[model samples]
Target: MPLLAYWVTYASLDRAQTDWYLFWRARFRAGEPLPTDLSYIFLHVYETLHGVGFNRPEAAFAHLQRLWRSYRVDHPQLDHHLVDWLADFIRYYDLDDEVTRAWLDEAWVHAHGDLAVHYWLERGGGGEVPEGVFQHLISYRPEQNKFYRDAEDKAALDTLLRRAVVLTDSFYRETTGESVFERLKTKATHTVERRAFSGAVFEGPDFQYTVATIRQYRQDGRLSKLLTQAVRHAENLARKQVGFRSLLRDVKLPANLAAYLDVHLAPALATLQPPSPVQTPPAPERPRVQLDLGRLATLQQESEQVRGRLLEETEPGEASTDLEPSISPAVPATPALPAAPLAAVHRPPLPAQVAEGELTEVDSIAEVLAGITDAARDLLRQLRNQGWEAPEGDLRLPPGVFTSTLVDEVNEAAQPRLGDVLLQQQDGRLVAVDDYRNELAFLLGTPEPAALTPPLDGPWGALAGLLSPLHLEVLAQLLQTDLTLGELEVFTTARHALGSAVLEDLNSHALDTVGDILVDPYGDPLTLEDAYRDDVRRVLHASGLVHPE
Candidate 1:
């Protein structure tokens, strides 16, 4: 109908008295070929008929069947949408007659049985399948359905198949006196060959695959061959160290087969043993030596007396008030020892006092050393005694003190006078920089270290005269070990200047003084050339930048 005539007819009709079926039927037949827009209108009519059709089951089924057949070829998906409707119709109206059964079978075939299968599985696969529905499901082939061939659809189908198998197995067992597999195996003509096995039954790899495959075979009514194949495959895989116990836990089998498999496999499982663990021998304990406290105190007093006498003798005519007299008045005073010859007394150079109340470089260095805490001083003494390097744990520090923080404190205290950091941490140990070893010892009142002599003649002597404190410090660091750019940065002036700039300045000084670049400026880790190492050390020692080991 044209839009004008269609609306005119709809407006003229008394809705309560109008026959909607005949009205739509006339509209559908008016156009020799139905208009495409009328298809939705026809579906609406079908829905209306379905909703009201239950009151007259025969009349509704006949009308829905005629509409379905008329539209099914052009609208194949119409059957998919009608699956639940048809199922409900048959179930609600109790329509199990031959005519209704034939119509439902044709519908199932047209819809590929996906919705029909889903409908039954949704109901827990219980109750009797309406006539023809079971036959269609049993005869349904998944490979032919393009929808089921898709990956997602295939997974859904597998889930449905598993549920169906479980439901069928449960129902069959409840209805009959035996399991599905037990009844199916009665027709087996061949015997299952037994094999030697050392593992428990159903203990193997790919157990899920075995279980799923067995379920599929059960659905296909082929359990007789499946049981024999599963046992043989499990035994073969067990020989290669795969287990099969997971399969039996997931898949139930006939009791006779279970007992037979257990009898053969359990003996081997019992004989298997786990490997023993290896044992290690215990380490020997170190001996502990206890100190005699009384003897130690006496020795310490005598040592203090000897040190006071030495200080008194070294600084003649200057009363050494640094120590109190340790000798007891109860004992007679010992005769004063004869003074040593002047040539025998080797006094280290002491810092000169400033008259203007301003510290000179030497006084500043001394003051920095004097300000060191007893803990820091002890740490330094240990490092010096251990050849200037000791594991951080071996050095005694107060609780809650970190070695790096202590090193930074000492270095910061000395930087203005020393012109560089004096201590470094390397490879988990505290190290006194070599350049300040003797200077530190002299300040601490320890014996002076032996002088290390390197050739200072000719060009080397000139180079020594030209090097600055910072330049000498940089060379000394490189001499000990090659330094990365970041490590060299610490020695740069103010510790903020670029390492490359420091190298350029040093190279310029060397090129002017000795006519050679003493260190490689562009190496990945900067290195001092071997030929110039002796000359550089001689410069360091000449300027008192480094001390002998």
Candidate 2:
């Protein structure tokens, strides 16, 4: 299956690398070791970070994280070839595994502390670490390595390192205490020789020396360039394999026969073969034979009566007729079965069915909304009172509107139910979905509310109708974190428009739509730059399918 998928995506190198990664991931899961060739893993990591493999880099990070965790269970130490790439993966994804965190910390302390610390700092860890670890993070110097690259790259790197140092110090001081740096220094008094000043001297030629040299080359940032070359080589090999496999699948030939022809007959077939004239064989006369015509006629009549009797048994109401007495004729068509009843038609379950455990078919919108939680009901009231009006349809509300007024109120909204009631606009506005408007009015006891016939298309279809593709994607992302306007600006602009000017226009248009969605009916309208949260995510898991409470 992996090979077939690889063939389908043969043209794309990134996709091929992703396939190769998954192929190995399965092996790791089954307690098998990975291939010695590190090219496949490196390419997968690189492609995933760049968002080429697996469509989303986050997904790629997750896959690699699982693979690493599984592979490390039996192995005591990581492969030397994987350290740099693994470090890059960790930096890009900010992985949270405790084992990985400890491994990275130890690896940096014992291996290339100077080079790895930049990535560590840039990634920005969430939790606290030992004070000595911060000292190592801030104090390491790249220039200590004799094999370090020239001054041109060094200057830029040094500037970055200085910035990282300041950031780390500030962060620790703020999070810990004013005397944290001094405490770190006191803790580092014992291991000063091991971590701080150990690798300045050159070791003579040996297996360990060779390993150290290779590690230096990688730390100096040369391995990534070599990995790119390896990727091209692997891609070339993959293309040939895919081409051969495709030929085999399409030719409908046995594997051995195909191999035999390619090996022995291919050269011979290359040269044109002369056409040979066809030969005809003469016909020979046969001896005379005789049959009784009266006996054959009697036998044929008996056979027809037997077939007619069998047909009568199969079709009770229809009368069977005798077969025409001939050697060959066209066959008659069989009778069609009766159509199925309307009740047997496969119609989807109504909205009432989806809400069966928590809500009833006849429950009012106010009652359902209130049943979710007090926070949820309050969120709806805020939307109803403060939501902005769309140009042509219902009022809309952005997540930010709720977030600005009530602290953590967005977490209170049930996305499943909210998705039932709120329609998503292309610009990411949540307008009260029109499908439930009448149902809601009825639920709220509005006088003379128009009777609404529940949609027969089913609950899922109705839910799908409430949001566009982009809305669903954005909502899913929001379940993880509140998306900033700058991120949204980049995302919407890159995806929806072509030119920079048009992208800017679209960005502005999106902001305007957001304003309409979060109009704040009783106060000042909300801006796009304001922080927004997904209330549905508060009640739902990352899958966005199951409600946690």
Each prediction's TM-score versus the true structure: 0.21, 0.17
Clash count per candidate: 8, 5
lDDT of each: 0.50, 0.36
Top TM-score hit: 1
Candidate 1, run of 10 with poorest lDDT: 207-216
- Local error of candidate 1 at residue 517 (angstroms): 2.1
In candidate 2, stretches whose alpha carbon ends up further than 4 angstroms from where it belongs are 1-36, 50-82, 90-100, 113-549
Candidate 1 lDDT score at position 457: 51
What lDDT would candidate 2 get against the real structure?
A: 0.36
For model 1, the local distance difference test gives 0.50
Off by over 4 Å in 1: 1-373, 377-455, 466-497, 520-534, 537-549
lDDT (C-alpha) at residue 107 in model 2: 53
lDDT of 1 by residue, 190-218 (tens): 11111111011111221110000011111
